[model samples]
Target: MYDHASRPGKPSSKEEDAPSPDKPPEPPITRIPSVLPDAETSPAATSANNTTPASGYAVGGGEDGGDNGGANLRRASTVPSPHFALPLWRKSVIIMITSFTALSVAFASTSLFPLTSEIAGDLGTTPVVVQVTNALVLFTMGCSGFVWAPVGRLAGRKQAWIGASVVFLLCTAGTALAPRAAEEKTRLKIFVAMRILSGFEGTFFHVTGQTWLADIFEPTQRGTATGFFLLGTVFGPAFGPCISGIMVTYAAWTSILWLQCAMIGVGLVSSIFFLPEIRRPGDTERRKAATSSVLGILKEFNPSPVFKVMLLPNVILTDLTCGLLSWSQYTLLAAPRHLLNPRFHLTTPLVSGLFYIAPGIGFLLGTVVGGKFSDMTVIKWIRIRGFRLPQDRLNSGMVSFFFVIPASCLIYGWGLQYEVGGLALPIVTAFFYAGGLLMAFASVNTYCAEVLPKSRTEVIASKYFWQYTFSTAGSGTIVPMIDAIGIGPASTIGVAFVLLGGVLTFITAKFGLQMQHWAQRKGVGSP
Candidate 1:
């Protein structure tokens, strides 16, 4: 489980290949055929640059020191390369800033939940009407990836990110200043429109962030980086209601939107200053080859594989597992206030929001820990088998699929039904539920990205496209389903989904390699 390498537990080489101390390395070859040359290359030669051999993969370069030679030798021996040198702290900061921005948008998207009652009252509408806004936002955010991904590919990561942030900021500000429903007769419409617009902007951040992280982090350290990113996304929805709950009570519901607007502002500023470009080595050549018209960039970025993956039996089945498992996930956040607020007579938004902490903590810890464990276990599996496959991560997720989601759903639902709605019941159940989700998600996500490394922009765009689409549908339908069926039956339904999801996950883990073969056979992600 451990190694003495400079990076971390993972070894730099599969086998020990020590460099000879006496060798003076060949002069660094700028013309080597690898990915693209560094940006420092003059623009005059940019057009003539051909596809180079893979050179960017080196984790670090050796150092050169004067005089003593031993210190330089040691530094050169230990340090991989300095060509792409970035301190871990800098990488982590970028991850935090980008991830937090993405997550804060996610929170703002759902932050209206704690204020649903107040919003409905002020707007002269029922809770159902307010709830519909939440549903549409999820749907829009999911589908919006198609639009954003192509733009990111064309304009570059930084430009596209700032573009999305600008839209998010504008829409959020509008939502805050929207007129009352009675006075404007169009206030609800305006609010809903703004939320949907924000959702579209929000999806860009997730897609961009996913690809950007993949570009920056090496395979071994990806888990911790991804874990931090997941923390932002997973914790946001859970944390949204709690913070907004306080804001709604102390200030107007508008204050939550205003706060969101400010957050978007921060994200926009960070993106302009800190976000770096992450095009592939030969991406410029590929893009130029693909199209000459500026508008053609959008046209060339097709969604066929994305749709094909969606239609795959295993992929579709995996999505079902994700969707069903998420039933409890979304429902817990959406409908809990109705139960607690009425039964316990807890009317204050802040008090109602306090209920989210149980699931929120569960989600954060589950994702962070699960991601770390996945990284660790994959190494173990590689050691045992004497080879490593990308799908190995999928195998690790099978353990969580069997134990976590179903158990948590049962405990949560039955605990509520038996009139055991104490704090401990939901808290314990939530930990398991959240754990299962992260475990499953980490695997599927890593597998898809790895399998389609060349087509990552499109692949990830497709992944989020479906994931959030399912989330939208779940958020839209969960409350109504709960209303129709009692908590006992509602949870039973969730358990049934979890069971199916578990079975599908098991099948994918077992057959994921074959699926990859199939994808390759079909030329799904060929470079």
Candidate 2:
């Protein structure tokens, strides 16, 4: 009774004969459906592609375009689907390995702090010169993101991770074997150069590692994943000084660098075998094109995008907030050695270094708890509003900003100022302070990764650009500021900046969507 091919949309015999021979045939209609059908057609998907799934989520570009605007719009469509879906256990393993890799890099960066005097004496230099090496490493670490972000873009994240680890391992060995020169200046120069090379390895772990995690996890699960990843980052600085204090107490200062070399070697080998290439489907072609020639590679190295991300109001606010937090973070790392050594009249590096454990534990707990809490907050807000926005996660940071950080910083500072509770008070306060910092950090870090998914690596690089610029300033000047104004006032300055950052964060959370629309309209971060 019915013909199979004669559907309502198709023309029957009479209609089919109406067209002239010169008329061109219409192209076949193609529907490239999403993995999750509901996601592709949902109301929220039509707006901005922000939605949570019941079990797993779908991946696709925003309706308007990829976050990099028109220039990357075509690339967004070409982005390959993930090669394979990894099991949860396998995904966890990858995250853990990358986190440890990050930890090793961070540990090497700050290990010299507790051993500054020992390193200076051995090389016939002053503590000032040794301290300059610390600032140089931090500065280099921040700037290295520019170079490595492009490498990740063109060469593949897997290669970037392995390459950085190998280079770090070699550089750590070089630092350990640095020859002592007759002149202090010459020896210092060698150490500075080696430290810079080592610092270059850090950006891969921080930037590319985060980028990799974002690639694997869904929005619902990303907060938890990012939190765990940050544990390695936050704990490394605290643990670095703790370990270095013990090492310098018994072993030669060079032994610390040797230990870093060994640890990094393990990470390099593990990453080579375990880390999979999670490139998009068409990314292989993109990678080949990007690497076709010297000019292609250089074209991929454009740092303009990193600066352009800063043009967005939300991004600049987040960057400034992170910069403010770095002031306190570095102050915490640098001050302990200076203040504890003198205040307690301690002789051994081990005793002074033991003090770092309190904050280290705090940093560990905060990242884990804060990360889980952020996810919960997102879920709760989704139920209330029936949709999710990236800024919703920022509400979790408010507690850390208003209460935990300010109170603990005051107790740590003024407690030392008036000598109220001795070393115990400041140590306990340091624990809470570090905890608060990480809690706030977890929300912001996750937000950055989600803000511009199309150009996530570049956006993240921009974050670190401002974040570490302030960190370099803090690391270089915190001790001097303590000397000039007393610990209480210096710490109060950090608290003021924290409050300002908190206010900005609140404003961004409330108006972030509007700001994003403005950014999109103005083409602020267009490639």
Choose the strongest candidate by lDDT. 2
Q: Once superposed on the true structure, which residue ranges of model 2 sit more than 4 Å away at CA?
A: 1-84, 180-185
Best by TM-score: 2
Q: How many backbone clashes does candidate 2 have?
A: 2
User: For model 2, what is the C-alpha lDDT against the true structure?
Assistant: 0.77
CA lDDT, candidate 2, residue 147: 74
**Per-residue alpha-carbon lDDT of candidate 2 for residues 88-141, written as tens digits (9 for 90 to 100):** 888898888899899998888788888888888877778998888898788788
Clashing pairs in 1: 33-52, 33-53, 34-52, 34-53, 36-281, 60-80, 60-81, 61-80, 61-81, 61-82
Clashing pairs in 2: 80-280, 80-281
Q: lDDT of all the models against the reference?
A: 0.66, 0.77
Candidate 1 stretches greater than 4 Å from native: 1-85, 180-182, 286-291, 294-298, 311-317, 524-527
Task: Estimate the TM-score of every prediction.
Answer: 0.81, 0.85
The positional error of residue 501 in candidate 1, measured at the CA in angstroms, is 2.0
